[model samples]
Target: MKFRVKKATKNRTCIVSAAPYHPYQRCKAQGHVEFFSDFNKDSLFGVITFYQHKYENKVIVDGIFTTDIGIDGIKTSDGRPRYTAELYNEDEEMIFDLTSAVFNNAIQLVSIKKELINLEICGDEGIIGKAVVLKRGGEEIARAEVYRLDPIV
Candidate 1:
């Protein structure tokens, strides 16, 4: 059997070319959720999108694509409710995924401590790498890049 491949468009992060079955519909119908804690003990959940693809003649999944921001629920000292901006990605197989949680609310707060973001990539040799960033907002976050160093070795 022959296969057709296409590059991802500017607006499209992931491109699904010719396949035995359709994967877009399957991903759209399914939703993956993740929960994380902020510095102040506030909780947030991220809903991820899952998709299936043909990699190296084998069926593999590109799981859980999301942005850095998850839920937009914030709290106020006066017992009021505040909403933050929501972040989303257009490309299903985009390069990065980020999630953040807020800590002590302070004016001119440049950064806070939070959980790491998750990144996944399917290499050309049928190897998959998953990475995570640990730190808060801004720079100085601990990042762990994982992948098979050498398949041939």
Candidate 2:
């Protein structure tokens, strides 16, 4: 997917994770995540894949996501703007808040950095979640629903 990233300002920093949140917990199983627009369930926003594991001695989850949304347009109170995806369960309880990954291209539309990773949204079922574009103060501008695809094995 093509994405546009605004020019990176001086001191613009991107957060990258080098290790799993739960370094000690062994991954037991794997699952898939795909997002759809809230307005229309059939409209797909993107896909995220997660692994079942534990963090800080308690069970937790993390995943990687990719989409077509433009990243640089997002605003923040501080000069450091970022995007995030919030995942919820069937009960409408939020399970995870993911920070959008950093993109490398500053001049034009790029493809690789649109992929986000290591989103630590916690839940047991690993069935579904939601994606949204939040205004600086936490207002929703665009939103999508998360769905787990059936495993092949």
Candidate 3:
């Protein structure tokens, strides 16, 4: 319903998509997003995040940014290099690994760019948005400037 963002160094622009309506009730759902950017060489430090999931009350938020996207996350517990992954709640909690999360998805990005993120959301009676939160140093910035993409394709 209401959202507030702080400010950051490298400003990133964003445009939120129109929220989808319930096929049956046609009532508006709740949703939002914020994205940020990173300039790391390891590709890990300099990365991108695209997160979107149906939370409680059927709300879906989406966004991309250059900072750490806040979500319950974990890495490989062993002594191996930890690839990043995010945990989101749906009917239950779901894990989305950067490399191999969805087996059925048609496409996958080898590297994730924290500055560039796209959301894939679907379902009936669901909510979705594109105005993602952009992060820098792990905090959501309130001064990050945002813009809209052209509506006509």
Candidate 4:
């Protein structure tokens, strides 16, 4: 099997709309909402096109991707919403899986080719720069880089 990977960001800050708008309007429209970076944007969400501002809020967020802001589910009280990141082979079948990932924050995995990875994350946040690997059964498939980002002023 093969896998592709990209550098992902952590604790990335971003602005979100705070108001409500009618239709066919961009986030810049009047009466729309705006939210400061009270949330940490994670790259594990993989191309977040849109997501609910709050798990119980009706607001739909077209969170900015250029700055890579928002979308990979924020810190849940009970981590109720679990995510499973899966890897597929040429036959389009899943082989490896990462279950119960915190906030289900899966990295922006490459989808063009194949790869092999090995990593450990039993007790992360202990190591300064710890990495993780995804495997299928006993075969290595992908790796994830865990790091923080400095605010770019």
Candidate 5:
């Protein structure tokens, strides 16, 4: 008796190819290429990565200063200072009314790490709502449109 090998058939069986096995091939296929110039300096501030959790976000600020300058023969002995400067949140509703005193005589700066949520809204006629960030200064820092999807079957 003689036995013979059978070839794979489309309906009964199939052949699968392995993913790219070689490091060079894999790198070439999905590697990131960064362009650099001779003028590039390593002492730069560099790119900072900020990761936000599903519920929280962070904001970073740098190089803030507050200076007190006396004016027009005003001396420390004077009862009232000649010049006073302050920075306030343009939007008073979002935050407390803070002043230089609150910041320990330094330039008013804030670094917030707070929890947040991703909200989605929908309306009739397939009109979706958007999420907006309203800064204390009345600035819209970011906005995202909502998307809707059916539950998995």
Candidate 6:
């Protein structure tokens, strides 16, 4: 028998359009992710683009994120790559984060629907939110700024 190893590539994108009546209706957000795994190299990158509107209601997010995981990536005590994602509101307060084991799986894709409530989106500033990725017990790896979407009138 013979075994051959090849590089693996994964790409994923998420698009969100909140309902007309939803608090996030005036918000626009998109997330992109890319991961490559191979016998020789492993790299992961992600970005988030977002816009917000004024509202006191809750915001519901719907989408799925997919990516490739390399053995060389961050690992858990059980020897599994550990990748995490987090979201923050205008105040820099954490809205949510994928930290559960279920977030890290052998599967190449995962589906997620999260609701963010009690967020302060009444700001006139274009910068409304931010998405970031941090190294395991280390500094930030990457970040994306979120902006406020102007009303169409």
- Tens digits of per-residue lDDT for model 1 on 98-145? 332222221113334323323223334221333333333433223333
Off by over 4 Å in 6: 1-42, 47-56, 61-81, 87-108, 112-131, 147-153
lDDT of each: 0.31, 0.41, 0.28, 0.29, 0.23, 0.40
- Residue ranges of candidate 4 with Cα displaced over 4 Å: 1-98, 102-127
Model 2 earns a TM-score of 0.37
Q: Give the winner by lDDT: 3 or 4.
A: 4
Model 4's TM-score against the true structure: 0.23
For 30-146, candidate 6 gives per-residue lDDT tens digits of 223222222112244332322232353444333222335543345566754455556655566766663332234322244343344333344442225454443444444445554
In the range 1-153, model 2's lDDT, one tens digit per residue, is: 333344567888655545435335444444444444453222224444554434432323333332344333432345343345565556666655543432122212343433334443345533445443322246453455544444356
- Candidate 4: tens digits of C-alpha lDDT, residues 42-151: 32322221222222322221211111444334323463332333434334445334332221332222223212122221123121133333332444434443333222
Task: Kindly report which residue stretches of model 2 are placed more than 4 angstroms away from their true locations once superposed.
Answer: 1-46, 53-71, 74-81, 100-124, 129-136, 151-153
How many clashing residue pairs are found in candidate 3?
A: 33
Q: Which regions of candidate 3 are displaced past 4 Å? A: 1-81, 90-92, 95-120, 125-152
Candidate 1's displacement at residue 115, Å, is 24
Q: Highest TM-score: which candidate?
A: 6
RMSD of each: 15.8, 17.5, 19.0, 23.4, 19.3, 19.7
* Model 4, residue 105: C-alpha shift (Å): 6.5
Alpha-carbon lDDT of model 1: 0.31
Model 5 local distance difference test score: 0.23
Mark the 10 consecutive residues where model 4 has the least summed lDDT: 25-34
Clashes of 2: 2
- Supply the TM-score for candidate 5: 0.18
Displacement of the residue 60 alpha carbon in candidate 4, Å: 21
| Model 4, total clashes | 12
Order of quality (lDDT): 2, 6, 1, 4, 3, 5
